[model samples]
Target: MTPPSPATSAPTPTLLWIDASAGIAGDMLLGALVDAGAALDDLQSAVDAVIPGSVRLAAHGVTRAGLRATKVEVEVLVDDPPHRTWTTIRDLLVAADLAEPVRARALAAFARLAEAEGRVHGIPPEDVHFHEVGALDAIADVVGSCAGVEALGVTDAVVSPIALGSGTVTAHHGVLPVPAPAALELSRGWDVLAGGRGELATPTGLALATSLAGACGPLPALRPDRTGIGAGTRDTPGRANVVRVVLGTPTRGTTDAPVVVPADAGPGGTPERAVVLETNVDDLDPRVWPDVLERLLAAGAWDAWLTPIVMKKGRPAHTLHVLCGPEQATALGAVVLAHTSTLGLRVTSVVRDVLDRAWVAVEVDGGTVRVKVGHRAGRVVQATPEFGDVAALAADRGVPVRQVLAQAQAAATAAGVVQGAPWDPVDGGPAPA
Candidate 1:
């Protein structure tokens, strides 16, 4: 029998892939956006809205490693500007009259920067002084890049493994190692590579990349409509000091339409493509499985489980299954190889159709418990209390786990919590009363 033909319809959302082979910086990204066709006037307008004529942005045509690119320069108009704190920056962004999406992206990037700085300085994000990155120029770079991205109408972003340079860099805190403390903090979970001999990825650059990139890996199979090259200020002899941005649509081969599971069935999941990694282990002690699973989860595996199987010579074995975003497959696979006895693993790309879901917190016995609400076709269908939250509440209140779970579900229903509501799991935290 012949195979079915691939779907002819275009993918619903578009993807923008960033090639950081040369390295990435805030100005570089902004320049790339302008080169890719974002209007400098519009980007400047957005920035001006936030800072009110404190800076000017310009993009110049340049060559790096013999490749033509755009180099963005930020000219600060203010003399002796105040070094802004995270709170100050956040307020400025929030009060800006920019487009909602652009404002949100810009604020998120700054928030990530603040978080990284806080981690390095041992302070809360609100209190962290931005130092060099808090200046008018850096602020303009971040805001302009974000506004440019929004102007391009990109729905998702994919990034190559970052190239972090070696050696040391001078900062307000004195001499810092290459990749810097803030860069290191920003790159905590994602893939990073070392190249060159200077500071390649700055803290602001890292924050913008991490904030926009939904996945990180090689450029996906795409039909490119436009490509932009953003050049860095310094020219390295052997390498291109530039960041590449490719705008395109993912190539969708013949595949079945996503199967939308009912909300009552379980947690709704991502609608994008995912990877399934499998391996068999027969020699490792059973006692080691728990630790291995924990490590995999911490490493960003979406879900992991083990299945019993019979191997050759009547030996009992276990098959480990790991499901994760395609961008995360390589990193999670490394964990499996290093922590397990398996010599090889199998990987396959799969499509997942998930019901939309949201996390809400409910008050029970003076403590809060989180509930996972799943929605299908824009209606709530499943409401399940998070086991971890239920267990903690049960322990705290000295009540049966079932009692806590029941009460939480009831509270969620009363609050009119449903799918399709505006709730960000990361930022919303436990919902407040």
Candidate 2:
């Protein structure tokens, strides 16, 4: 038989599944990347570019519970650098001459950390002081790991339930419980295990995992191509002190194929494949519906809503429906199952046809407001101010909401974004006169 032509076969999408069952830390994650074929020299060079000559990186082969792994060590050479704030770190990362993707990933990971720290300390994220995590070693670990991720070309990431470990850990702020306040804050809404002794998941590890992974669950069906074990420093008895990363190609379902709608379709819209998950509940407290809707949206539901209905025996009920991308179906479904009283849910694949829309920022009264433009056949069909931005501007300026809306629409019209007449403030509506 003649060999299949390479051009005929589609390239498989790469996925990196992290097994944090033993827990995760920044060094452990970097070590995992090193073992999985990310070039240590490249990682070192990237870290050097970001943090200068403040730290040295080393990767050593080791075994955790008879399983081979890689251990990464970061040696800080600088003598007690000033405690940096979140703003300082963000400025440094943004100014560094790094690849755009690497810079973005590093900044996102740090932003997650900053947000968690800010929440824990009751302060703004920009003003949050980084104590131990602001050190050169932490910087190297975070930036180097992100660089490695970029180098490996791993596009999708999934994390297993993290083992949080138990007990107490002392920080610069004082004696904090195991899993620390920052770690706990980061792990909120994430699957976490509190078994085992001492700290398993650090704040850095939680931040990186939560920031990078789009979904959290058991390993999806995939054909494993490579595996790497990252060893942790502590050796708790009866368990392997390592995090495992598996790289593979998904064996189930289509690989994110875009469903293009025909030009003759209604409204010349582009339709994308999505899944609709739904359930009906008649017994839950009505006060919790708002929170449920909010959680579903936060958990990656593109849109979620509740509809009033009549259940058996004329009992009033609600039908909760969530729309999301196909990849998030399972995770979001789990969210519904966990948060609601329904024992089961209905999932159906759907195609959502939408107009070609773009967001453009318009300056109004000192602050920038975003306006959404919907186009059909390359011509603007509808232009509207984002209500959230309009409301914020209105509150800040102590003006009517309609006035802010008019100003934003007028700004959009002035920029030639919309073809028709602008909204008139005097008439409080779109203008033709």
Candidate 3:
């Protein structure tokens, strides 16, 4: 596979910020997107590609607590099947004739639901049966929502803290808490709130939200060109029971620290900003710390680490620190909250001056190890071989890791990938040695 490289010509991605402050459901989100201009016919066509004439979708404008909103209702035309297993659902999606992205998104959402259900019921994910989510309407909601998102051309999404609701409700498993166990499981690494009475967020809804969501935070700075409101069943007396969608292009140089930096930055290095999310945990199992860090990095954190500390009453703890792009603050914060015993997170925006860098591949023994070269003012300031590459080469050749590291260092130096060497603008450094 070719190595990763920075994008040089991609267009600025469009942002779809979902406001689930009131709550969210599969149909609620779909309605919001439709109201915001995602064509309903397109959604129906996509759903038909999968279920094929089994489900129908229609939308109408209505008022929820004095606010106008759209409600898209799913009507099943055929006899719905009994509870379906994750394996069955997976096969159906794999054979679906939908767009690649739409199919992929739907599959991901269902996969999350299956995993959550499996964990809650102590069954393997493939063997877990989806009861409520297996219903025809639920299937329509999941598939149509994915298709709606694609129709709008939304490239990225951020979700606000979700409202899980209060009280209890009855379901296929009998009486369950407001935020059903499966929903709660799926919401593990997301910001959530109990915004109202009854079940505001359902498992299917949370599955879709968490699957599509890239981050969780307040709406970033953007010039919204379209807004849509989707109403839930109840038109509660006071508050509007609705989900909101805001579509726009992110505005740079505004609050929430834009990722794009101005070109006039000083010569010392390029100045960019990142957010630091920190939290302290004392009650978590120590054995799980490594997994926590791994999850954070996998979730898009630039870096994650732990610092030991002592809390009140001499209790020992560790403060988890996550450094990430501003856009990733809430998402990474959610990961920390989910994996650790922390009840809150502290977010701080920091400006960093970073040197220009490039990658160089050098032969160590017979293996290639990529070296990261940092430079400033057209001079190489630092050069270091990637440890992952070095370790792999050591394992392959059955040599001591240190020996491989030493040889890689010498190879880099011989290749002029050293401090103070004139930087090569072509691909950031000299060609591989």
Candidate that scores best on TM-score: 3
259-326: candidate 3 lDDT, tens digit per residue: 55547544756676778988888888899999888767755566899999999999999999989776
Clashes of each: 1, 0, 0
Q: How close is candidate 2 to the true structure, as a TM-score?
A: 0.59
Summing lDDT over every window of 10 consecutive residues in candidate 3, give the lowest-scoring window: 1-10
Reference-based TM-score of each model: 0.59, 0.59, 0.60
Tens-digit lDDT track for model 2 on 1-433?
1111111112356788889999999999999999999999999988988778888899998878777889999987778766888778777876787665566567767877888899988998879776653567678888898888878876678899999989998778888898888998999888999868889899888877876676788887788887888899876567889988988887754234457575665655767778898899998899988977876775546799999999999999999999986645654664565457887789897788776555667788777777666655546667777899999999999999999889887887776557543433232233343
Higher-ranked by lDDT: 1 or 3: 3
Assess candidate 3 and give its TM-score to the true structure. Answer: 0.60
Evaluate model 1: give its TM-score: 0.59
Cα lDDT, model 2, residue 205? 87
lDDT tens digits, residues 1-433, model 1? Answer: 1111121222255679998876789999999999999999999999999889688888899988788999999987877678788788878876788675566566667777887888888999889876543568678988899888878877668888998889999988789899898889999888899867889999889888887786778888778888899999987777889999999877753124454454544443446678899998899999999988876775446799999999999999999999987645544664675568787789988767665555666666677766666655445556677799889889988989898888876666666554444333433322333
Candidate 2: segments with Cα more than 4 A from true spot: 1-11, 132-134, 253-433
Ten residues in sequence with the least summed lDDT for candidate 2: 1-10
